[model samples]
Target: MDDLLAQFVIEAAELTQQAAEDLLALDCEPGNRARLDSAFRAIHTLKGSVGLFDLAPMQGALHSAEDLLDLAIKDNVELDPTRIDPILAVLEWIDRCVQHLQRVGTLPPTAEDEGAKLVLWLASGRAVTPAPSPVAGGTLPQWAAKLFDANPAIHRNGAVALRYTPAPECFFSGDDPISLMAGVPELVFARISTRENWRDPAEFDPFRSNLIFEAISMAKRADIEAIFRLIPDQIAIAHDATTDPSELPAESHETTTRTIRVDLARIDDIVGLVGELLTAKNGMSALVTQAQLLDGGLALSRNVAALQQDIGRLVAQLQRAATDVRMVPLGDTLRRLSRLVREISGQTGKPLQLVVTGGEIEADKTIVDGLYEPLLHIIRNAVDHGIEPEEQRQIAGKPAKGTISVSARQVGHRIELAVGDDGRGIELGHIRSTALARGLISAEAAAALGESDCLELLFAPGFSTSETVSDLSGRGVGMDAVRSSVRRLGGKVTISSAVGTGTTIVLSLPTSFAMSRVILVTVAGEQYGVPMESIAETVRIPASAITQVRSNEAFALRDRTIPILRLGDIVGSGAPGRSEEMLLVLEIGASALGLVVDGIGERFETLLRPPAGLLRAVRGILGTTVLGDGRIIMVLDLEALLA
Candidate 1:
């Protein structure tokens, strides 16, 4: 029973997301009848499922929403923005109810009142009468008729005719057909017979199941469906059969398949084990290297190296398998933002259109979950601050409706997501003056700042150009939070804008948080890792190749001047290496930087573990990893270090 409840929660959450997506699509493309039907089915399924549990409030709310959608479908009623909010409200309330049920196995006390209000609000807009109950005492089948006649006084409000044929190997799969049929609520009659003729006793196979179970129940259709939801393919249901039982359709032969809903803790445990496996594999490789250095261990090293290579391959495969389980499509996350855009646009009285692309790209679930708030902040900022009013847009020779596009794509081993708007771009002069007036930057410094530098000030704490605080902007906390959250996930966010064109904010994040491929390098005689996604190229430079640009050390690479930083000096390890040094060129947004390191090592995938205690507060380091030879290496935060 507990397992069933857990599965219900997972399915309900998925259905809620689907329903939300359909609702948003329906709003955008009102003529899309298929979307309307899909949304209605999702709500109807949710209502039936919730009815099986003790969640009456959820059932009631969903029932009303379903009825409202039915009216839209049957009567072709056009749903305006005002009518859409109540339906969305019902979804939001359902989400809350699901959360409460997950935590306490029951709905909250206030759910009843809140649900009543939502139902009332929905019903006030459309004339929705409750569906009539199934007709009482419908015609029974020949097999059930005899049993009913024998009793005569047994009153049944509804009749469910079920034909269940257990699979031949169902016994091995932990199925007890008789026990399942016995648990049916209000069971009035049942007959069990063999699907196939019985064989001779000597040839009989007790392990195989060939039973055909037929039953009649007075329970509601929803209740009956719930009882057999897990194995629907094995059963055929006829509700309040106003016809002969023989007229029922054959049971679906398709096998019932399901996804296992493992606890998140269990997945985390598996990830942790994979991390340890990777560490151990690397340790074995290190030992093989050490063995090869010994005089008489060469032969042994060769054999061990072969074994180590095989193990490494297996570990890599395991890592990928584990990560894939956590990957979710970006569409799920973006669908949520659609609702926010609608609400904010309505509140600000600004007409806006949201366009999304590359939503099929997949990323780690953890990263996708963390993105909700930061993306919300960015989208809100775009609608409220970036987009110009309709009149202003038309006067500027632009369309009356503003467009905000959110897109995602896989960039090598990283995920690049951008939220942009075709609206009046940021005003650099206004930002410079605001920064100077707010004391965020000195007047002299503000005057000398470039466009990119001026844009950076937007992320500064409490830096906003708005003269007054409103519901959306002026608190001056949105961008800063976005930067903080992105950085915490080992990613970077950058903003680019043109004077009158538009603005785009891009986020580059690792494809997964559990593991990453990094290039190992030695800085100040200590080993460190730089994410491979950030590395552009590696070159060995002579001492004479270095140039001094004002007070900064830089060099020309591919006709572009790139700044150089000594890794030893930045981490306080030691002085730069010899006259000839290995330089790692890193791409950070639109700029490139060269890091002078003592030596560059091989690149390999490794698990990233979070820092603890004081290490968490440290900058320039994303996390730590255990190397093959048991050496602990710090993963450098290239973006933060350069910032």
Candidate 2:
């Protein structure tokens, strides 16, 4: 795709998102003038951008939305929930059009009908259609005022103001835009300007139309439209009523933040390059050690060590910068989900409010993107099953409106994002019944399980409490998918609930999935890595300290008897007989276990690529990382092993 089209996709998506958020906010507080104006400007700007392409349907829909917002802001029309919904629907339609354009290089075939429906919905409040009609003879447009200011000889009174922006490819269509403008009846003055910045002289293409024609005509609006009949979408006609530019309808001017849109794949490539650089940096340490073994190498080794130190510092900075680039604020994702909540609420006829907090907390782009699907499923379930009906809520002494809240916070190198709702919480009895009915859990097992244990069953594949199938929830595949997705991102999912209060699910995820700190250890002469986050500490204990308890081993440390598991035995490698045993105390959630290894080596931060191919089916392995010597070592998933 061309650069302009690609940029339009990105920017159109952003504009629709902003407008959706602003409209949602307006739905709650109709009197918020700032939000109203912001929504108006976003839609207006998006319309202008859409006008530059062959997206006439999108332009028409957005034009109607902008007109509605303008009426609301100027004529003091109350933007209640009724008006906000259609505007949001239009934005959603535009977003879909943008996505289709990105995928197929043009709008979908249904764009015309969809845009028309949305335009009709937006224009339902007024008698006029989506197209621009003749303005009353009292207020001149801003563009017309500028045209008169530039050309002092032009007659301003009762002149029809026209701004014609021919399509870039109009020249190839055998249409002379200049000739069409010359045919305008009683044309008095005209000004031609470059539509955009001129390209490099050598690379410029004369075949592309790059001019915008602004003219004042004594002809009627109908006569001007007849002249530009073939390209009605590219022309705008208004009656020049008043000389004062201030008399025109006011539009909010926003100070835009300078930013650039980058492809996520590019950032991932940069991260991969940084990982390779880290591997090369690690090799320098091995070089320094090898230098010391040669004759008269003491001085050489010292210089090499100093140089390695400098290079190490630089590599660390580069690593940090690369990781920072991969980090993105969760606010955008949360806002998008908030839009989803609004949609689900509308579909279910459930009055709901979404409150988001700590949206500024940053996480890896992968994590943020992966979060949407799981979160969407959760939000659907929340709206469909969790939130009780309005009448039921009233009888239960609860508010008629249900509230769903999503909050995030950072703890060390992990992010704790909790999605909660003020609705009917999951019932333990219902969960047990559903599990039993689906044969997910035995009756005996259900009786022995505690509250948390029963909640965990919710994430079991094909385990759901919905009795009937619908567009939302029903055939299972909700929480289970949530768990799988979170686990794939090196994250954990947990749920807590109060019988009649609400349910809150917390997802603990690594801040960056690319790089991880692992403690290198040797088990049965083969090197392996254990994630540092799961380890409490490393301790040296004598063999005699291990005690047998009912055919199981336990070790005492600081007045606590932790269960012991040999890494060699777990990996099918025979236990190594040693006088002193090295134990890594692992703390995973509420369980603590001691993992005995053959030897513990240096701690290193390296890229932990997810398992692929046959390795993906293997259990108890998180991922693989490359060592300085180019050997691939397996990073053990201690939690998986313990489970």
User: Residue 169 of candidate 1: its Cα lDDT?
Assistant: 89
Off by over 4 Å in 2: 1-9, 13-263, 293-299, 346-349, 411-413, 426-471, 478-480, 542-552, 556-561, 576-580
Candidate 2 CA-lDDT value:
0.79
* TM-score of each model, paired residue for residue: 0.61, 0.58
Clashing pairs in 2: none
What is the C-alpha local distance difference test score of each model? 0.77, 0.79
lDDT (Cα, 0-100) at 237 in candidate 1: 54
lDDT of 1 at 262: 69
Supply candidate 2's per-residue lDDT for 233.
Answer: 63
lDDT, residue 395, candidate 1: 90
Least well predicted 10-residue stretch by lDDT in candidate 1: 247-256
Candidate 2: Cα lDDT at 583: 94
Per-candidate clash tally? 2, 0
Q: Tell me the TM-score of model 2.
A: 0.58
Q: Over 4 Å off in model 1, which ranges?
A: 1-263, 290-302, 357-360, 397-399, 410-413, 427-471, 478-481, 492-501
